[model samples]
Target: MKRLLRAVPIAAAASLAMPAHAQFAKPEDAYKYRASVMFLQSQHMGRINGQLKSDKPDLALVAENAAILDVVNKLSFTAFPEGSDMLANSRAKPEVWSQAAKFKQYADRLNVDVGRLLAASKGGDLAATREAFQATAKVCKACHDDFRRD
Candidate 1:
């Protein structure tokens, strides 16, 4: 019957909409989240690079003045699910989800470094800000080198 047909499609869609994310039901979501965080972090860093590369004091001041901690501040405490199949084409190493503890440690270090950078920036100290920024990059790179596929 027509009623039965309608009910069947609705039921099928309902099943697909189920939100049973296995601690990590889709692996690619991890990659997506990582990409999101890194992209946001780099935006400001890119500005800093341009300012330093030009060696313009006024440029440096303008870059620092326009800077804010909010970008990195909003990125903490996020965790990716462990084994979602959505990660099929991702460059993230399975070890990242497999070794959650180490992954978390690296994330925490980034949070700390960003926090320090935020404070240093507020003081208008460009040198300290650059050091903290590099430290944050190191934390991210160190982990990626070991666990990322590419």
Candidate 2:
């Protein structure tokens, strides 16, 4: 009876985990997930920006936020599936599908700039972090200008 109880719990856990792996089963799911990730990234970036503007910027907080941004930047590309552009709630432009290669290039550039920002934050140099942040923000702006709808 104990073994049966343990097995039941294990089976239930496995079933719960299965849905997590199949999270983006539809195009709208992917679009919604991408929107959530973008929202998270923006929130983290805003935190870092707020810190940078403060008189006593906290390097530790900056490093943590930058690390999150680094990971989020890598994850942002995976959400843009082929048909995701057609989703009603998606702010992504149709050019994302038509100009896939260009969009990917911009994504790569943003990833690189985010990496630099993370490195700068880790180095604990406020000036370097500011410069890196500006570079990263510019990459984001350029991509948004070209691919995202206002």
Candidate 3:
């Protein structure tokens, strides 16, 4: 009886801690989340770019930004469920779902490029960081061109 009571409260607390629509009750929610994450990724990328352009670039900030980009890059792909592409406000192209394998390949390339960027940033080599950033940008543009709408 004591164990059951303890488990009940723990279970309830765990359930309550989850987001209201943790499973995405509507496709719009997934689309919104995806948009938000992309915005965050862009912000981090912008920060890195700005730092690189500065007369005295801050390698620490660049590394921090790259780390953030690495994490966000991992998260972006999960937001695109089957129905998420159908959301009225979503800028995701239908090809993202129709050509899922290709989309995933692009996403994987992004992961690799971001990892390289993170590694270069950590090494504190400005030239290498610039090269890695260019590689990452190319992956982003390729994915966006194939999977996103204007």
Candidate 4:
């Protein structure tokens, strides 16, 4: 039972990454995959922001949204495979591929930032959570400014 409980979390984490491992059939598919994942991320962030703006900020809800953000965040970066920027629906700039290392740096930083946000929310510290949220948003904005087309 103890071993099974431990494996459950491991299995769950692996499943979340399953899509990232799959080869997208085409550039459009890759764009769609990343776009969908990013959409989910945006929606979750909006939900957390809404909770934060409420008179009675619900740290629990924030944490829930943060958790979802944490997972979707990891997934989106993986979908930005080569040549996906050519897709009509893609807003990704050439910099995403041209300045690959810098783009990856942003992706890695965003993951860490979101992790911090999750920790702050789970700790039930509203101020800390707000600070962490802002930090995460800054990373997102910086990445968008550099890699995404307007």
Q: Which candidate is the best by lDDT?
A: 4
> Which model, 2 or 4, shows the larger lDDT?
4
Model 3, 1-94: lDDT tens per residue?
2222222233322322233323455667667877888999999999999998999888889999999988887667766656566656888998
Q: Which stretches of candidate 3 lie over 4 Å from their true place?
A: 1-22
Better of 3 and 4 by TM-score: 4
With candidate 3 superimposed using the best TM-score fit, by how many Å does residue 40's alpha carbon deviate from the native?
0.5
lDDT of each: 0.55, 0.76, 0.76, 0.79
Write down the TM-score for model 1: 0.64
Write down the lDDT that model 4 would get: 0.79
Q: What TM-score, over all chains together, does every model reach?
A: 0.64, 0.82, 0.83, 0.85
* Cα error, candidate 1, residue 89 (Å): 3.0
Score candidate 3 by lDDT.
0.76
What order do candidates take by TM-score, descending? 4, 3, 2, 1
Question: Candidate 1's error at 68, in angstroms?
Answer: 5.9
**Model 3's TM-score against the true structure:** 0.83
How good is model 2 by TM-score? 0.82
What ranking emerges by lDDT with the best candidate at the front? 4, 3, 2, 1
Question: Can you write out model 1's per-residue Cα lDDT over 9-114, one digit (the tens) per residue?
Answer: 3332232233332222234544566566567667766665566556553434533533543344234223244343144566667686567668667766766787
Worst 10 contiguous positions by lDDT, candidate 1: 16-25
**lDDT per residue as tens, model 4, 1-150:** 223223323333343354436355666777788888888988998998899899999999999999999888888876766666776778899887678768778877888889999999999999999999998889989999988889
